[model samples]
Target: MGLSSRSAVAIHALTMLARWSDKSLTSAEIADSLASNPVLVRRILGSLRDADLVRSTEGRGGGWLLARAAREITLHDAYTAVEAGPVLSRHPHPPSDACEVGRNMQALLEAEFQDAERAMEERLSQTTIADLVQQVLTIERKIGRSAR
Candidate 1:
């Protein structure tokens, strides 16, 4: 299955919130970082809000923030919030049962695909938004030092 960009956007947004935890961020700012539009950010943020990973404020001087601590939120949290279904997709149509390989392919693919999906989930769960924020900070620090 194709990896959805939604998960990337959600993680990026969450890391932004954590990095700038002192203040709320408007969707437009996040969108600008993404080179995307506010509408897409809002929609993805909506899904994250529904998952309780994020919260939003409205009106003047209002925007979005994390609902929980960044460390409490895992990459799996972001992935699940915005994307659904298996990370590995099966065949578009069931293989013909008449042929030997076709008959066995679906089952074999299902087992292997599920394993891959589980492995990805395991890896994602191992990481948190806080981890990404720190990585970003470290990279920026290195860049600054090099510039100086």
Candidate 2:
């Protein structure tokens, strides 16, 4: 019914990577900033890595790195990487055919859902992770808080 937090988490992790481009970061470190479980962060990171949005290494001095420049990565890319299904998935079971609204609801909403999905993807495509990082820093500066 609503946008999943996966997109938000992916964007946040990407922004953090962009802000700290000089160093690789562990899932635990990124998770701390998100105030989320490291397992969740790692799961997201795994998807990002598979999507070529991030790369990782193991051992001492090992951590995750941006696979490409922040400017080359789009929110749409991140969104697609983590989300497995349509932005608005249909109900688990179709409404009863006995009900007129229930029988036609899916058909009626399909186009609108498609349009919404396209618009969302288009918007996401227009903004890169670098843009997001800049936006965050700008907001912080305006509020007199240092971007960390």
Candidate 3:
């Protein structure tokens, strides 16, 4: 029915990872930055790990790291890795068949939804975590905040 914040969080976490590629970061650390729960961050990280977008380690000085360069990962890639649901979904049951509008509404909406989704995917494909990181840092600098 609606979009989820998982994709946003994934992108944010990835941007941080990209910015600090020299060191690994624990779920708690990421959670702190996102103002979210460590468990939730861990869960999200698990999904990213499964998607091969991130790697994790345990024990002393262990944490998560990007599987590859930020430039190699796109917003669309992050969106898919989280298994976010479709941008649009139909009603559970068809509307009344007796109604002319109801009978063709789904078909009409489906086509439009597909086109919208394709357009969104195309735009996402053009952006990367590194790009987002750069934007964030630029804004921070403009606001007189250190980008660390």
Residue 31, candidate 1: C-alpha displacement in angstroms = 0.2
- Which 10 successive residues of model 3 have the least lDDT summed? 83-92
Residues 25-71, candidate 3: write the lDDT tens digits.
Answer: 99888998999999989888889999999999889999999999999
* Clash count for each candidate, listed in order shown: 0, 0, 0
Residue 135, candidate 1: C-alpha displacement in angstroms: 0.3
Worst 10 residues of 1 by lDDT: 139-148
Each prediction's whole-model lDDT (CA): 0.92, 0.91, 0.90
Runs with alpha carbons beyond 4 Å of true place in candidate 3: none
- Cα deviation of 36, candidate 3, in Å: 0.5
User: What TM-score fits each model?
Assistant: 0.95, 0.90, 0.95
Q: Where does model 1 exceed 4 Å of error?
A: 145-148
Task: Output the better candidate (2/3) by lDDT.
Answer: 2
How far off is residue 135 in model 2, in Å?
A: 1.0
Clashes of 3: 0
Tell me which of candidates 1 and 2 scores higher on TM-score: 1
lDDT tens digits, residues 48-141, model 1? 9999999988899899999999999999999999997777777899888999999999999889988888898999999999999888888989
* lDDT for each residue of candidate 2 in 125-147, tens digit (9 for 90 to 100): 99999998899888998999984
TM-score of 3: 0.95
